[model samples]
Target: MSLNPPDLRPDLAPKMRLDAPRPGQPTIGMVSLGCPKALVDSERILTRLRAEGYAISPDYGGADAVIVNTCGFLDSAKAESLDAIGEALTENGRVIVTGCLGAEPEYITGAHPRVLAVTGPHQYEQVLDAVHAAVPPSPDPFIDLLPASGVSLTPRHFSYLKISEGCNHRCKFCIIPDMRGRLVSRPAHAIVREAEKLVANGVRELLVISQDTSAYGADIRFAEERGHRAHIDDLARDLGQLGAWVRLHYVYPYPRVRNLIPLMAEGLVLPYLDIPFQHAHPDTLKRMARPSAQTETLAEIAAWREICPDITLRSTFIVGYPGETEAEFQYLLDWMDAAQLDRVGCFQYENVAGARSNDLPGHVPEEVKQERWERFMAKAQAISEAKLAAKVGTRQDVIVDDIDADGIATCRTKADAPEIDGNLFIDEGTEGLAVGDIVTVEVDEAGEYDLWGRLPA
Candidate 1:
């Protein structure tokens, strides 16, 4: 087990599986980069393409054209996106670029002018048009039919449900608002309809994601449509009744978020919240132009626990932000000690192109940033170890993610989110355990980031 777990990379996309193309089928390869939000965009694009008779190619050699879904969240991510574009161009000469990076077409084209076209985030029509221009879709009416649930980059057991597009927050360190524009929520009935189809298609977990989940119907005024309200709490209640695990992510700790806790307590949704608490120090938050309510947040956490003791709080933080003093960093460390968050991810701040934080004064030196990151992770690892040790004697309902040929099963508890959180391993007595099966196991062993358990006799 890893003692000091690595910081979660929001840029990582889930592994995708594609079927082999039939004879003379138009095929497209996708290099989907960035977070689950972008992955959802890729899924939508591919679903549209599939409906138009395009087969998804797992590799460049098999594809007639390649689509590079880019991430421009950070400078490093921009570089990565450029590299992916270059690689796709090398492998498949026809390339279409889209995503956050595509918002700045010049930025993408400057490095790779050979790309056929570039479209911004969630521009399905533009992407489809680009694909059609590059690769004429030859849909055989009998073979080219869209699946009910659409093309999903995630496994069939779980899917990322994007509730809205863009964010209204102007956090100095973030450029998302500039790239993706403002919050635009889909209709409440429409979102529920999509979730219903996904559930019917065998998706057991629905990870609700957006730039700001709490702010979900504020732009739409929580408009009600056909028995569903556009509010986050109301949306959660509707999704919970769909007989699937509903996990909320990217939730800003607005006062209204308290309403979701009781839903978790009632088993209407998973008792997990993925909040991005960038820093704990008020001064640091002020510098970042984020909410500086560290004290009130602690109170909120306490209140949430009071309502649902079993709730798993997962948060991401940033250390070494511009002008972050040693005292400020220590304040964050002390806050972590008090929070005792069930799952924690910490990032050493990096400047992104066009981000307001890049202009902020007193940027922390690289050495200081690295040192602070190490210290922050050590504290987090200790907390994780102790918290996990407490669960050693308890029982957890885990969803089987994989069952190996050797019969060892890799599973995740309700507290764990796929690709970002810990896992529970079942090394023996694993007969008949299949992927997507939710089974209860006795927790017998604990480590810093994983647990080992077995089927109860």
Candidate 2:
């Protein structure tokens, strides 16, 4: 699986020329928003900044410089990004903005007057250099030096590991095509090296992420560069060999994904897959500018489950896409009922400014959108509870995350994919555990979205 591409010159650290301030660094305040992919990008920049001797400040109040990594996936997200930029301007410090939102010329120019510069995923490495080489400069001593250890702003136990960047999908509701550009996957060997580094620093779980993970190897110049194709299955195989508990997220269930089911069944990778199938109705999908082969897509899912019987499939549905009829929404709900999905979430469609759907006719009203969203979630919550209840008598491996002040212990299982997913709650007892310790827990009770469990003595 270590198929190294011949053309990619591997450099563990590529040297970049940026002027450095003499003997001092400033405290950096970083705010990362959006999905796991954005988090991974933020992590890389933060790692580089810390390596360059910048002290990280928890709050923006006293920091000498501020960096805001933003999300531009939806209209609401764009508004929040603008709000963050305004807040960063109030700091009276050197400001930097990056991420999909920074790709917008109007947003960067209009909102962030105080920002010294703005960059996107294409210029992440360069942005770090800019932060270091600021003319006003960081006030601390040892400016040109790197930190002795990599600092993680997140909880120490787990981290979001991104495999690649950007998307190639042209779904009408999505603005990623306009914002993040096309899919550009990193070499598998490089990703493995990065994962090894993260593991050395205490990350136990690797969340394999991308906009469209199944399309991983398509952009990779495999024939001339590598002797093989750069695919998610190959990537998953490589990551599984790392011996960390690996998880896959944002995987689209295309026909090619069937090859990955066996890897999931092997237990090296978790029996979980995140597929964002927006809607099940074929006509609705076509109007949304998505793949219209409804039967084939469902057949692929059926085939995957046939091979990997234990797959914990999670997907998302959008209720209010333009031109979606009442019958179409009902069809999606009925499809959900038929699929018996283990985990599911529903989002009401939003008309993003740059997306094509904004101008589409037959837009669902706000009240109607809200009602559909509520109805779908109401059904989904029941299904989620039933699925968790089924596991009430089983023992699952969970990473212990905390012992809260109220004597409640919280953690997550391999089945849960952090942030947006469910958690495992254990009543505090004399067993005595600390964060990052993986233990076997017996589930005793189940709630709407979480499992109540106790660590084995």
Candidate 3:
């Protein structure tokens, strides 16, 4: 019965659930934090452990040791990661910390000196070494074979396909490039091969993710192998052929992105884009060292809509950044009104420890930042309400995500991404619908960020 909150923590990964461990298996628990990218890292580490005959425990009490995969994107996230590490340390007594926060080993050790070890993000071997030292793996070669799709932290229905690591952009508000380093894309064939295995293993959706999805192969010069190219457009086309829902995330608004619209229009991929247009004002964007082409972006949006009318545009924005004037904030509101983006998320800028924006002049007061956030969210909500209202009579194809005991089926349309966007709920006649089943429903009612639908006769 809950609608999508106005302030969704889109950066969070879906909660993890693991199968029971085999008898006498040395189990390790994982506390995955941060974005889906980090979640993928956790999955990789767990898969490697599983391959070596280690079991994944879902909780501290059941674990021999725990891995705290941390996020250090924002000050708040850092605090949360530290808190998670502390809790894991207390509950399990043995913890290995790895992730963006692990990049600052002294910071973690300063907070929790009891941690067994700390390894930076995606350092699988180091994490494994730490784990092997903490809890020796007992390989039951007859039973410890890894699954084809590996140890998925997410549900079997959908998987996050990280095409690349790190980012090249040095935005003032971000330290990702500093922490994760420059873009390093996976080979085209490797990604496609992974996707094929995921599909074969019952994954119905592929959430393509990266630090900057549009720049997937920039570092590799868009290399081609086995009939697949590392470029975003080519990759999307390749993934689309796998017969699963392909949703792209963290895409920058590059001119080349327009090429993907035709693929969406052709039903090759989901007609959805999750871009982060941090701010709309040119000055604000320039200060953030981001592209300040608001006018060009609006035109590109219009062009995209013309090509793929059903496309759902989802974007996140940062408000009240350093040097943001009230006029600049209002300009953003005006831009939102004109753009009429289908899905939106907003953040009130806060200084991360190493971000360049901290030294920028004219930092807005905390109260002003909160006030701007409220106003921005209000605008976004009103737009969302109207947009959902318009879909009241439309028939949408939704993938069932869950079915409650009361028989309410929670589903997401092509316009919706899992966990972040609005949902279409089927209140009755959900007897036959199971998780991952796609069905057509007639929208009967709508709220600010959700819809009530019924199975079509």
* Per-residue lDDT of model 1, residues 1-457, tens digit only: 1112123453355666677777689999998988899999999999999999999998999999999999887777788789899999998899999999999999888989999999999999999999999889899899788888888888899999999999888899999999899999999899999999999999999999999999999998999999999999999999999999999999988877999999999999999999998898888888889843565899999999999999999988888899999999999999999999988887778888798999988989888988998899899999999999999889999999998989999999999999888899999999978899999999999999999998999
- Which has the better TM-score: candidate 1, or candidate 2? 1
Residue 90 lDDT in model 1?
A: 93
Cα deviation of 344 in candidate 1 (Å)?
A: 1.1
User: What's the lDDT for residue 50 in model 1?
Assistant: 91
Q: Could you tell me the TM-score of candidate 2?
A: 0.88
Instruction: Quote the positional error of residue 194 for candidate 2 in Å.
Output: 1.3
Q: Cα lDDT for residue 384, model 3?
A: 93
At residue 435, give the lDDT of candidate 3: 93
Tens digits of per-residue lDDT, candidate 3, 86-122, equal 8987888999999999899999999999999999989
Q: Is candidate 1 or candidate 2 better by lDDT?
A: 1
Show pairs that collide, candidate 3.
none
Over 4 Å off, model 1: 1-11
